[model samples]
Target chain A: MYSILDNSLTLRTQLFSIVGSILLLLIIINLIRREYLKEGYSLLWLLMGGLVLIFSLFNELLFSFSNFIGIDYAPAALFLVLIIGLMLISMHFSVAISKHEKRIKELAQENALLKSMLNKKERKRKTSKK
Target chain B: MTKKSVCIIIPAYNEEKSISSVISSIRKISRRYDVIVINDGSDDKTKEVTEQTGTGILNLSFNLGIGGAVQTGLKYALAKDYDIAVQVDADGQHDPRHIPQLIADLDSGTDMVIGSRFINKTNYKASFLRRLGITIFSNLILFTCGKKIFDSTSGYRVFNKKTIAFLVRNYPIDFPEPESIVKLLRNGFVIKETPVEMNRRATGESSVTPLKALYFMASISVAILIESMKKY
Candidate 1:
């Protein structure tokens, strides 16, 4: 009875890993192919998906890595890596947002200035015509 | 020396009630200074009212906050090649009559001039908590820059061509008033403050609340420290 239960649990874990990793890979590829994600940003997601697939295919490697990191559970190690990856992605996004915000501010200022200058020129032309 | 062209920049947000009066008062002062009202994406009739006054209006596409509005004005000043730019509050707290005094101080070759209410006080009383925050910022700036700025929170200020150019390129976005002084000092720009009578706002509620005041104090302190650490 114990042997059969252990076998079933192992099969379920393997199936879950395979399905989850494939789904992640497919979604990331689809996004890139559709141009919804830029090449630069997609590189990170591709790397993350590739790592998940590698670990899922070689469960022993994941187990060893978890042991090396002193994590008792192998799946917990994957969660740890996922959290770090998300944090890095968020940090990158913050930097990009700051840069874009500065650019937008400069553009708005320029737009306002140009409009004012054009108005001045128009007024001058109207007065001269009169 | 030839007279320097001056542009009065009024950053108004939902200030329809007092904007017309402010523009008229500026016009009454003299035609020497051109008035430009920055309708900072006001939902009210601020743009229409300013238009009726016949002053130039820089209508922002969206709300960029006070710092963005002021920087827009500076950018305009730079592009238009105006020698001086004066910032006046559209809420009518800053008296436009004091503008000539600020300009006079700028004439002494200072890169920037601030119109202060605390230098020679009238009945301009800030709330106790707000005054505490201002005092703390004043001392922080004084300690860091070694220059006493009596009213660091006062937005009423004048910028010469050089200062205006620098600010147009790089100005603090949030809680800019006090931190800007630190930036100017770090860049080796000269700044002077003159006493100006500040009138109580006749209309419109102040944007700063008690909670915002606390946040303002913390953020401004951080900004001042970070700016002081910079080489330039």
Candidate 2:
């Protein structure tokens, strides 16, 4: 049974978790507000911030959950979650980059084809005038 | 039946030295066929050379590789309602003289026809390693599709309107020659090959070097496998 005063989390750990979660939430909100990050991506960051906030407020809940997951240390479990989330975000970015690259190639090809057609038409006009 | 119009697609990249000669050779063959040159972001006088020939030219804003360039030409052909589309290299290697043979084969209801150098004999010779790579690709394609293709890497090909429409919608972007054959076979398109003589390149270096050839073989093999597993 985990108690609030189980001494599993120190005051410094609690302060760090609260401060870090607040900072992440602020950064994510600002990014979305500035249109630097899309809403779809901001949702993921917001969820992470919420999780951090919840774990920090209820230290007992985090400790119990870490024990349930066979983790000896509660903070390690939080770090593990963060690592997995980062890996997923990075993978998503890679897929998005591949799609954009394909689109850019298609656009470039279309631009070239249209330019050539315009040149041909201009030449035809000049020839007819001559 | 009405007469079918043919469009000759030449995908050239920095082939200023040979583009004019190639255009002239095609012009000598016949005036009935419409010629379109796809300048794949040539950093030279390729566009001007093609323009001087008074042929239709499509200048790409950037280099999209050979497959992308060829597909762009196919898109143009499809848009213009061309009945037949022929692919000829910008370099003088692909002789326009054999284009008639490709068209004649297409007349027999063939969906796609390939101008192969190794059909009857090895008229055009490559390095031993290159030949080995081509042979491996041929056998691999044969094993997977149950179709024997002697010159799987030859870009000299003819496609009917149906094939052009299909390619315009779906075509690979890299090392597309061998892989496209597998795709065409999987889609149940009838393909035939005719003997054609290929010349050595008039100028400029080939994109494929020895190291790149190895990489090309590996990637092409994977592409063929993936293409075969795709549903039509």
Candidate 3:
């Protein structure tokens, strides 16, 4: 167990991490409140903020978890978690993009079909009048 | 028996130069068969020329790629209750002469008939890279689908009413030709191929360049694999 009073975590370092995580959460909440961010997509970001908050509050937890996992470097464990989180987020984005591509294609096709149908009907009307 | 109705769907993208000739050739075959040119957001005079020729025209608002264009045509065919829909390129590559043969096959029983360029050693001279893609795609299709498609990439095809109905719902958006074959076959649609000669492009360049060829291969191959593995 380590604390800010201990040499491992300085009070300034603790304050920085805690402030960073809180700031991230505040920005996210503000975006959601303003309808700039959908609640559906905010879950992952909120999860990230909460994880950072916990890691900052319990400064020794990351080191201890890394040690338990036989990781020689505590910072490497942080890097690993960050890389995995980013990979998951990127994967989520890819799936969303694929869905949007399918939807956009359908919409475009429908638009084309409708425009052409209208053109045909207009032409038929002109021919009938003649 | 009632006479069958047919619509020739030509998906054109900036292919105004050859489109007129293509439509006239089909008209020469038989004026009774309706022709509709799907001007796929062409920045040219394709729509005006097609209209001037007194043929049907579906001018897309924007380019939806070839797949979306063809699917739109199929949807229109379904709506108009056409008995058969034949897809022909507007670049004058697909000889409309073989269209009757393709429709005949569809009329006989086959849900779809592909006009294959490599089936009977035709005079079609494909580039080495093009031939490689065809061979790999054909083999991959055979291995995954358990049926041989000699010209899996051929866009010249005729679809019966039922097939058109299915395709309007399930056509892939990008590089859809090869993928659609596996999809239809997996869903219990009968597909056959007949030898048909292809003319050299009368205008524009090949859509598949060296760089795009890689993208074409990867995307269509993955799409085909997915189609083959899908259950129901």
Candidate 4:
């Protein structure tokens, strides 16, 4: 209800979207170069950046896209797509986390096993030496 | 039959009050059987108490829930190369006296033996809600695995070395008892259920709340379905 964004893409917002998309793409590339982001993830960010760049470049297409999708509110259509994109990214992270969680569990189990074996050996050695 | 080396895996989480008694009772049952307690990061003296009894113990850095603790014990069993591994609750719910019978069942040509309370009439009792959950899970397991198991939720179980090796690699992390049955059954492992009486827990109340129970039901149902859908 608080969405005051009109169907017309304000030039100021259009400029911001273009700048933001370009900036996001640059940051993602820089992150990959700095080893902060892996190549595996940089591709996803770059694709998102390309999509945002395409939309920012063509407001006419954005309007048509929203109209085609039955979203009367053009900005709402963009928001919806952005929300879905966020959801997908979150889900990808969740899948990655699940994989790592299993590994962490195995590591913890192995750690306990080794520590217990050491504990057993130390006790046995102490008793036998006495 | 050759004499089999057995490991009694008791996954204890803050079970300090009853762990000592549980260990002693198992030791009383047989000295030949090795006992290992996976101390699930209890702030209590569970590790110390277990050490005093001279039984082996794995002190996890944090609570890994019941499934993780049990899997740790399985890993230990696999590493130690025990012929059979029987899991007993550290809360004193499972009687150690039945270990031999479970091992016997395992030896009699089954990969797994579950100490079921429903196979025969026993003085053991459970709440109506809990029983409803048990019924639902057992049926879910049956539907997924094409076999009727009376007590899918019973943790009092004995696993042969092969099963232990499998579970060490694939045991579920949350509420594993029911899903493990489905996984085992689907993978062509035989699970035999025998009637046995279980003592009411001697110390703390069950950790299950109503909401957790609901989640447990839903998660396990989905897990069973997914397990059944796998091709191999």
lDDT to native, each model: 0.87, 0.88, 0.86, 0.87
Ranking by lDDT: 2, 4, 1, 3
Model 3 agreement with the true structure over A1-130: per-residue lDDT tens digits: 4333234557797799899989999998999999999898888888888887888888688778777777766656666777787788788889989999888877877787788778778989999999
Docking class of 4: medium
Cα deviation of A119, candidate 2, in Å: 3.0
Candidate 4 chain B: worst-modelled 10 consecutive residues by lDDT = B223-232
Q: What fraction of native interface contacts is shared by candidate 3?
A: 0.96
User: Residue B23 in candidate 1 has what lDDT?
Assistant: 85
Q: What DockQ do the predictions score, one after another? A: 0.62, 0.70, 0.71, 0.80
Chain B TM-scores of the candidates: 0.96, 0.96, 0.96, 0.96
Native-to-model Cα distance after best TM-score fit, residue B185 in candidate 4, in Å: 0.6
Clashing pairs in 4: none
Candidate 4's C-alpha runs over 4 A off are A1-7, A123-130
Q: Calculate the i-RMS of every candidate, to one decimal place.
A: 1.0, 1.1, 1.6, 0.6
Number of the top candidate by DockQ?
Answer: 4
What is the number of residue pairs that collide in model 2?
A: 0
User: Can you give the TM-score per candidate against the true fold?
Assistant: 0.92, 0.87, 0.92, 0.93
Instruction: State candidate 3's TM-score.
Output: 0.92
C-alpha positional error of residue B27 in candidate 1 after TM-score superposition, expressed in Å: 2.2
What does candidate 1's lDDT look like per residue over B113-210, in tens digits? 99998888677888887789878888988889999998998999999999999998789998789879999987889989999888889796777788
Error of 4 at B168 (Å): 1.4
Residues A1-130 of candidate 1 have per-residue lDDT tens digits of 1222222227678879889989999999999999999999888889888888887788777777777877776677878988998888889899989999989987877787787778889999999999
